[model samples]
Target: MGLPKRDQQYHTYADYLGWPESVRYELLDGVAFMMAGSDLAHQDIVGEVFAQLRNALQGKPCRPFVAPFDVRLPKPRQSDEQTDTVVQPDVMVVCDPAKIDRRGIRGAPDLIVEVLSPSTAGHDQVLKRRAYERAGVQEFWLVHPTDRVVTIYTLGQDGYGKPEIQELVGTTPVGVLENVEITWDELVARLPKIEY
Candidate 1:
C-alpha cells in the first residue's frame, strides 16, 4: 500500500532533507525509520524532563532541546552527504553553542533523555543507546512512564559504565549537570493516574 520496498534505499542527510516536512523520521546508519507518535503519558514525561532541564540551565551556557530537533551525528571528518545518522531525542542538553546551527545540532548533545514508548522501547534502549555511547554523549537517561523509573548511564574513560537506577518517587540530581536536581515526586504528582 506504500512505496515499494525496492525504492526504500539507504538514506543520507541530503535525502532526509527531501522528505515531507510534516512527518518525522530518523536515519540510523543510513536506514530511515519512521518515528512513532507520542502518547499523553510519553509527552507528559518529556515535558517534565524538559522543564526541569530548562530551569536548571537558566543563565548557564548549556541549553535544552525537545523532540523534532534534529541531531546529526556525523563520523569524524565525514561530510553531511557521506554521513547518515540523525536522531531526535525526547530531551537533549548541549553546552557547546558551536554545534547548534540553522538545520539542527551538528554533533551529539552532552545529555540525552529518552521517554520510552511501547513502539520505540527497543530502538531507544538498544540501537540508540549504543549510538549515543559511540557518539560520546556524556550522559543518557531512559525514562519509563509505566514503571515510573529512570535509568541513567554515564560515560567514563572506557565507555558508559553501569547505569544508576532511580524510582520516580524521590529527588535525584542529574549526573551531568552540576547543581541540577529533579524532584521526581513533584513530576509524578503532575502525571495522570492510570486506573487498573
Candidate 2:
C-alpha cells in the first residue's frame, strides 16, 4: 500500500537540496524521510490560513511565507562531517530579516504552521513540534482539515508547554496575531476554495 520505512541517510543541506522538485522531503535526526504530498483539501486549508496571516500582517513588521522554503537550525556541534538538517514548513512567519537568507529562512521563525495530512500527522504533531519549540519558535499551528479545526502551540521559556485548541464549527474566535484579531468564521468562509 505504501513504501516501507528505511534508514535513509543524508549528509548536508546540499544533499537534500539536490533533490528534484517532484517530491517533498525532510531531514529528521540526520536521516532523510520521503513525506507524501497533500491533497486538495489540505492545500485549501493552508491557503486559507496563509491568506489570513498575510492580510493581518500587511503594513506590519512581520512577513508571512509559504513553503518549499528551507529552514536550517544549527546544532551545538559544528563539524563539516556532521549533517545539518533543513526543513520546509508548510507556512511560516518571520519577523527577523537576518534569518531570511537567499536560500531560505535560516533561523527561528516567529510562527510555524503545518497543514496536516495523514502521512505527516505523526511528524507534525510530535517531532516537528518538539523541534520548533526547541528552536524558540514563538508559535506553532497545526490545521486539520478532517477535524475542521486548528491547534496552536505557543513556546515558553520552560518549553512548549501546551496548545490552545480551537474547534472551528461555523464561526469561532481565532487567536490574536501581532496585535491584530481575526475570527475563524471569516477565515473559513473566505479561504480560497478549489473549484471541482
Candidate 3:
C-alpha cells in the first residue's frame, strides 16, 4: 500500500510544489506517493516522542520537528527542477540553521524518527530506509509502537552500517546527538493501551 503512486508517471519537485496543500504526497525518484493519515496510536506515539525531543533540545543547537514538513534530498549536482526525492519524516531534529529554509528542510536532518504501522512497515523499513541512507541522514530511528522497540541506523563513510535495536523503554541513547536520550517509562504510561 505504501508504494501507491498517484499515477504511473515520473514526478518532480516542481510538480510537487504545485499540488494543493490539502493533499499530501512525497516524491521518491520522481514518483509521487500519497501519504496516509496517521491513526490514533501513531499520532500519540509521534506526539509523545516529539514532546520529549522538544524538551531535551531546549537551549540546544538542534531543533525537533514533526511530519508534514518536507525534506528535499537532491541528488548531487542536481538543481531543484532536476531533483526528485522529498520526504516528510515523522519526527526530525535539524542541527544546521542553513538547512532550515522557509519551505522545509533543504537537506538531511541530524536525526529522523519514523513511527511504524502495519500499512507502512515494508515501505519504511525498505524504501525509506534506503532513501534516508542515500541522502546522508545522520541517524534514522524506526519506532515500532506495536512491538515497543526501536531500530536505529547511523550513517557512516560507507553509508549506514548495522542497525542498533533497543527496547522502547527506559533511557535509550540518541546515538547521533550527545547527552540526549529517550526515557520512555513515563511516555509509555501516558499512551493508551489498544489492541491492534
Judged by lDDT, which candidate is best? 3
**What is the full ranking by TM-score, best candidate first?**
3, 1, 2
Candidate number that wins on TM-score, 1 or 3: 3
Which candidate do you rate higher for lDDT, 1 or 2? 1
Expressed as tens digits, the lDDT of each residue in 80-101 for candidate 2 is: 2353656788888898788887
Pairs of colliding residues, candidate 1: none
How high is the CA lDDT of each candidate model?
0.86, 0.71, 0.87
Instruction: Score candidate 1 by lDDT.
Output: 0.86
TM-scores, one per candidate: 0.92, 0.82, 0.95
Model 2 segments more than 4 A misplaced: 1-7, 77-83, 169-176, 186-196
Cand. 2 TM to true fold = 0.82
Model 1 per-residue lDDT tens digits across residues 1-196: 1111213688889898888988788888887888888888888788888998898899999999998899999989878777788999999999999999998898889999999877888888888898899889999999988888999999999888799889988887887889997778877876657431
Candidate 3 regions with alpha-carbon error over 4 angstroms: 190-192
Best by TM-score: 3
User: What alpha-carbon RMSD in Å does predicted model 1 have with respect to the real structure?
Assistant: 3.0
Model 1 residue 147 CA deviation (Å) reads 0.9
Predicted candidate 3 versus true structure: per-residue lDDT over 123-185, tens digit per residue: 889889999999899999999888888999999899888998988779888888888888888
